[model samples]
Target chain A: MNIKEYIDTANKKALERMASVQPILIDIELEAKNIIPGMDNKTILHAGPPIEWERMCGPTQGAIAGILVYEGLAADLTEGYEIAASGEIKFDCNHDHDTVGPMTGITSPHQPVFVLEDELTGKKAYCTLNEGRGRVLRFGGWNKEVLDRLNWMKSVLAPTLKKAIKHSDGINIKTIIAESLHMGDEGHNRNRSGSYLFLSELTPHMLDTTNNEIAKEVFLFIKKNADIFHLNLSMPHSKLIADAARDIDYCSLVVAMARNGTDIGIQVSSLGREWFTSPASIVEGLYFPGYSEKDACPDLGDSTISEVIGIGGFAMAASPAIVSFVGGSAREATLRTRRMYEISAGTSSIFTIPSLDFKGTPVGIDIRKVVELDETPLINTGIAHKEAGIGQIGAGLTAAPYDMFKDALKAFGAKYL
Target chain B: MKSNMNDLLSEGPKVINIGLRSFYEASETQGIKVVHIDWKPPAQGDIETIKLLDRLL
Candidate 1:
């Protein structure tokens, strides 16, 4: 296969297909196994590349143990840990099943997930709902309280949102994301404005779908948590968009970039489902009071899916307020987005930055350009405590290690050159 | 014969700094005009990797 014969047009098609897809929040599913292809009762899907239970990081192990207990496979987290260690639980990558998760990115078959779809291509992707900050499962928090929150989400929140979404004939996430860019949400780590926009779409329908008390309770559950309620929705929205561009012959743009706590992985458009990985990098940023760098885990999560299609960190110029949360100056945040264009193959005509004279956000991370340029994707993310149950300690900045891109380029060469 | 450096330095040393950012920062602190290029050793300064990259790029 001569890459020169096909690469340029192939990449252009990949970029076009990626940017053109409109991910709409079409449904809320009760079970991950029902919507996610290949997920099973005993299988626990995780973020980033596949790994055995022995090599799994602390946060991931904690999250998995909690989910096992939630699935009723174990009596408690302590027992859940032993079952997880015994290898009785099968593990799979979330990307393989068309799903993404945040932080430790644990997805049990019974957990609630948002299903986003592109009407034109009928492509769909799924992501589990976000449990609001502090002692949440995504950060490896598991106990009676944590299980109670998960249970409440399943019993009340999921059904309410499903009814509201169906009542509204599906919320247009593409529209909310476009508008939110102007209001300062990169659609990843900073989603305060997007949450309000998401609520604007859902609130009226939420009122119509449920009784007054339930509506108010669910409404405040989202309304009070301004930063994260929209994030789970954003992840699946980006996943749906990125899935459309995967497996295009000779296209070298990255389709997914996620960290499994132990390793950070990237899947290229031309490389099919094979992942190029590097040891997960330590995040650099401010820690919460009483906590320091020592408490933070390595970069972990499936949230980078938003960056894969260009909103998250790639659209940093549109969300300067993120500097305070992600720990950087406003200028640095803007520069990060400008720098991304150097490695990206294209820009999204829809997700434009107001600060940059309405210029489109850089999209399409090309693996060849990444190797040549030696610059990697800049990510803004939450930092989890290395110990399970400690939850999030801070939020910060990280980069995909360059070696992964080099390895991917060599693989591309071996196959195409 | 005239050198570009001579003319450049004659006007109080405007600088085009590459790789190391401290040099550009020092120049800027002195009110000198400076541009910093964020340069790095491509392919990690490995000749074999560069050779491979050359084939594909």
Candidate 2:
């Protein structure tokens, strides 16, 4: 098909996929069952293209090492290396359970994940908690403070949010996402607005339905940890909707993309359960003080699923303020999101873009477009350091490796037509 | 009433974070300098200094 015809057909299919969309919320059990949650981790959490992690920039390595220690599977860095080499710890992706997470893609068993369940199709997706900042465990900072914080999230924060959500019969993420975009959040890198919106929704419920003591404590914690505590919820909510778009026969859509620290993988709607993988790409961009690009990890984890389904950076125009967090300009933000239309299947009904004059954000990824147009999916990602202990260094954009798509196409051609 | 932009511009050369993909044409008259900082290897708070040189009239 010609590109326009191809795009039109793809758009129609994407719309259909979106119409069937639903949100799923779930808590993942990271029992060393060979799965890691989130997109960038699923793609190249290891050491190859679409990303090459062996030459990874440093902070990423530190994060991975920290997660190993956190998991208690390794005594130290040396042992972790042996374990990774031995492949004793299987790196399963959270997308396998329809989940996503932030950098380092570390979702351990004890962690509580907010699963967004799309009530329509009964599909469920998961994402871990957003531990309030400063050398977080997921970014490869596994200090005692990080461990303690993770424990607190499991014991305190998760239960409170769960209670609040249950009281409200679950949160309607689409409404919040749309509102946040207008309030200067792109719903990925800049979730400040979304978090406030979430708190606003949960606050009333927490106050009324919850016991006064629990309500007071939850409110205090959320107020203190307001650097977008709801991001974890947003990621899984996106996953829930994205999962509803998965596995249609003859559909060339992308169902999911997620990663563990060791591998990056993508699942196409047509291909169903198969994963297209490349090594995670090392992030290259501006760095914090005393840190350089050298400290960043190759891209790892499922956060990109938001971008794939449109919202993260793809909705950059909707959140011009994001320019401050990820580094770019207002015009660039507008274009980044607009360009996604070249490869997408359709726009979302629930997640509309305010800056684009209320046009819907692009939704549904098409693998056929990836091949026919030679345009891979673009993802805005957080940059973890390359070394085993350093943690997050920065965030930037990374495209899916082209070879994975080419390979998937070759495989599809052999089987379908 | 005072405007937010008026207050913001008065701060002068503040460090702002943004994604690499968000760049576009910036204004020349405002004396605003835009420096591009990469978000890779995300540091705690990385800031870049932008010095805007006047274009020949």
Candidate 3:
């Protein structure tokens, strides 16, 4: 077949695989090593592509140090730094282990992980529970309070969720994602509606399975921080969906977009696991009080998995409230979603935006379209402090550096049609 | 709602371009067709007016 015919066939196969994905929240479990194979005491999985400890940026290094302290491998921040620099710890990408995490995307051996299984493909992906906002380890916060919360999640929250999830066969995440989109959640940076919907589904099971006090506290924690409770669930859900489209020869679909504070990376589906990386761009958007651009680190997170699967920034039209956080008007949010459609290979078979007349959100980021149009994928992300321990300074939007897509396209042409 | 790939592949998928000519041009580049709708916000980008119109509509 010629190049045109070859590309057409590849696109068809990629889109079919994408449409077949059905991600279900199957269970919550303790010990990341148990669910995520190859995870060990010496292994540390982080977001984005692999980088040496010496090359890691402030926030990522900060998070690594925090994980070391939290895991009891190191006594404190100073000791943690020494341990990281000593090269005794093994660092790898989360994607390599069928796991995903938001922000710094640190997955230690001992943390509790939510497991998502694609019903159509029976592929499983894992992500740790959301630590909520400030001083969280994902954003490089390694303080005592951060360690305490991680411990609490392992001891209390994880067990509670495990019991609640076990009571049901599995939670159909696609249904909640669709319903939440209508109720004003883009299923990424803004998950207020999605969080509420998730709690509503699980609260009944929690009530039946757990003691009153425990159930009440879990419900309150979910309710109080309704904005991001669904992030962990969404990350793994996106991972399962995106993974379905991987390894299709000659297809130009973007399967992953992630960033460490130091570098941003993209992996094209047909390229297998090869990453095209560029310098992580500093985000341009609103900042939190007492914080400014000077204090913000470059865009960081594996949360762009949401965008890869066609929600988050790509579904911004569905959540106008996100504009307040990302620094844009409601109309601009709608336009952002529309603009994504221009470069996408197809619309999502699941996630749809209500405001766009219930149209399916754009899906399948085509590198060919991106390079041809000179448009890059837009990612909505949390800004980490340039200093690791300061945690999230703000949330904002940033474009995937055009060079990543250009590089991927170049590699695609060289490897295949 | 699930969108079928066939619909996108079929000829004459009408696009209503709102503001940017670049979007219309981009669609043309992809072998898709477009009809540029020469449109602007009512009341010329006035926030209060737009809010009032939103309520009135």
Tell me the tens digit of each residue's lDDT in model 2 across A227-319.
557677778777766666565555567767765445567777667688887766665555677887656666776777787678886787788
- Tens digits of per-residue lDDT, candidate 1, A1-417, equal 455548878888988887788888899999988888987888899988898988888889999989888999999888999998887878998999888999888988999899998988888889898888878999988778899999999999999999999899888898898999999899999888889999888989989889999999888888888799899988988888888888898888899999989999999888888988999988998799998888888999999998888898899999989989989899999999999999898889899999999999999998877887788999999999898888889999998899989888888888886
lDDT of each: 0.89, 0.63, 0.85
Please list the Cα RMSD from the true structure of every candidate, rounded to 1 decimal place: 2.2, 11.8, 11.9
TM-score of predicted structure 3, chain A: 0.98
Note the DockQ of each predicted structure. Answer: 0.55, 0.02, 0.02
> Model 3: what TM-score?
0.87
Worst 10 residues of 2 chain A by lDDT: A41-50
Number of the top-ranking candidate, with DockQ as the measure:
1
Local accuracy of candidate 3 as per-residue lDDT tens digits, A1-417: 666566768877888887787888888879898879788898999998888998887988998888888889998888989998998999999988999988889999999999889897789999999988778899987778999989989999999999999898889887788889988888898888888988988999999999999999888888877899898898888888888888887777899988888899989888999989999989988888899989988878889999998999999999999888888899999999999998898887678887887899999898877766566888888888998888888888889887787677667766753
Model 2 has a DockQ score of 0.02
> Taking the true A–B contacts (Cα pairs closer than 8 Å), what share appears in each candidate?
0.52, 0.00, 0.00
The residue ranges of model 2 lying beyond 4 angstroms of the native Cα positions read A1-14, A24-88, A208-217, A224-227, A259-263, B1-57
Give me the candidate number with maximum lDDT.
1
TM-score of chain B of each: 0.65, 0.24, 0.49
